[model samples]
Target: MKKSILLMTITTITLTGFISGCSRDYTPTAEATGEDIFKGACMECHDAIEGKENIFYELTADNKNIEFFSKKISGGSLLMPKFPNITADKLKAVSQYALDHSADK
Candidate 1:
């Protein structure tokens, strides 16, 4: 009886943990701010959106416009992945954020 009770308790705890730890939601919601998106996606590889020391980073040629930033970010590059899920507003926001924080600025 004691062994049976112990086994049931263990099973209950294990199941509870397993069920609670699971996440079935396949899609993650987009962040509201440009800075948020930059931090979430761009920061991983680029590190600093502006003030980059790498030569390759310099040639990005923002062109002092949100359009450039939007194109580069949405289109992706050789090493970077495309951000298809980013909404138009989010795209604009992030682009502006990058431009605002650019090395020149």
Candidate 2:
């Protein structure tokens, strides 16, 4: 009787662990931030030190919209590479950050 009870307890504990692990939704370790995304990706090719003028100015001057910017980021521009892997939310955040900085001037 004690052996059966021990076996059942072990089975229950194993099942509980397995079920809990499977049910957990994985949370990404680092949430993407606009500034971090821009610095990591956009700055690679677009920094002023590289002799490329800041894109924010042109974006504002042309009255470009966030939707347009997000699409271009995901789809790539004539001079830019496609970033379709970037999440839509991250793109919007980055676009807004750029626009906000553009207006600072």
Best by lDDT: 1
Best by TM-score: 1
lDDT of each: 0.62, 0.60
- For candidate 2, give the lDDT of residue 94: 76
Candidate 2 weakest lDDT stretch, 10 residues? 20-29
lDDT tens string, model 2, 1-105? 999999999998876664443212222125878777776666545545233355444544555667766776677654565675566577788777666555422
* Backbone steric clashes in candidate 1, count: 0
Clashing pairs in 2: none
lDDT of 1 by residue, 5-99 (tens): 99999998876665433222212246468777666666545654344542123334547678877877777654445577665787888788777
The alpha-carbon lDDT assigned to residue 63 of candidate 2 equals 57
Error of 1 at 35 (Å): 0.8
